[model samples]
Target: MGMMDTLDEWHSIYIKAGIALPGALLSARFRDEGSDEQKMGLLLATALACLLACAAAQNNNPTENLALRGRATQSSTYYNYVFGYLASAINAIDGNMDSNFYHGSCSFTNNDMSPWWRVDLLKSHKISQIVVTNRGDCCGNLIDGAQILVGDSLENNGNNNPSCSEINYLPNGGTQTFECNGMAGRYVNIIIPGKETYLTLCEVQVFGVPVSKKPPCS
Candidate 1:
């Protein structure tokens, strides 16, 4: 039989034997002992209460799922900009990318000189929307242009890559939201091509949805 079945059988035999065993031992010691039924009833109640207590304890012990949380911006400490595949959560709805189990891996930058950041998507991803959030108030990078490079290449040799094509443009500040035209690309490059103010960045959010040519039907 199963272990549970054996336990149940043993418990049944114990309960049966307990009816007379406790009272018989007590009667041997005392002249007139308490009733066996009362002793058996008390033991059964205690056993039931202990089983319920164990069940309650198991229920109270719950496991919490761990995930990433954003850092508080109000703090005075400064954090440098960062952007990579591991930085931002992959939120492509077309089954093209994977979700980021952690948060805030992607970010923008503000460099006064030849300010630019390169992101190698490695493979072509049809991206349509990008949401940018400043890491702190009065802290943001001047984003003059956004481009995407198609195919396999990572030119960190200080050579301005020719294959990179501009996908979005912002001549001045107030550029937190960028809705791309559903551009397909492998490598994405953001150009801070101007001598803007002190650069600051918080987070960069890339969202991908299916590109639809036809307008909404009435």
Candidate 2:
């Protein structure tokens, strides 16, 4: 049987043995009179309960967007003259996934060589996935070939960090998820290399757990 099945079987056994009682009550009830089997069963049940609780506590949900708790910046901001809107980097982390740039929810960088955007998670995390939302109104293809990088170093504005994934293509108004497979880092960067072009993103979502919370290397 699989690990989960084994755990389920143990859980059922724990419940059937009536060993799920309060710790103090169980200790008092079996203090001096219970058979050795009963005492051992109680000890095993307690251990199992603790194991389950620890497992649940360590379970990291890859869907939780850790970017929302961080700060963001880009190489340069795009200014809309008529609308008087500045496409700031913080727009991407504002939790608004509206892909229309005109809606003022997307972040845009000025046309520049190797324009980059980054989010500082403030602490190291074992990043498992990243989701990028492409602009729908226009210029969606500009995001193609962008590199997703993760690391703790600030060298070259974090563009030099280890790459997580490269975007081959993301359609207009479409959201794409990239798996990083637990790359440890404090900074998540997105940059378009080898071109003088605008970089726009409606949303950048990062999923992971803090490094301190991760189990130690075996």
lDDT of each: 0.35, 0.84
* Candidate 2 runs further than 4 Å off: 1-42, 53-60, 214-218
Q: 99-178, model 1: which lDDT tens digit per residue?
A: 12123322333233544444444354455545443332322223334433332345542224433344343322233555
lDDT of 1 at 168: 42
Q: Count clashing residue pairs per candidate.
A: 4, 0
lDDT minimum window of 10 residues, candidate 1 = 66-75
Candidate no. 1 TM-score: 0.34
TM-score of each: 0.34, 0.79
Pairs that clash in candidate 1: 87-105, 87-106, 110-199, 135-202
- After TM-score superposition, the amount by which residue 160's alpha carbon in candidate 1 deviates from its true location, in angstroms, is 5.5
Q: Write the per-residue lDDT of candidate 2 for residues 1-218, one digit (tens) a residue.
A: 44334445555644533335345434343345577776667667656665554454455455568999999999999999999999999999999999999999999999999999999999999998999999998888999999999999999999889999999999999999899988999999999998999999999999998887733111
Q: Ten residues in a row with the worst lDDT in model 2?
A: 16-25
For candidate 2, the lDDT comes to 0.84
TM-score, model 2 to reference: 0.79
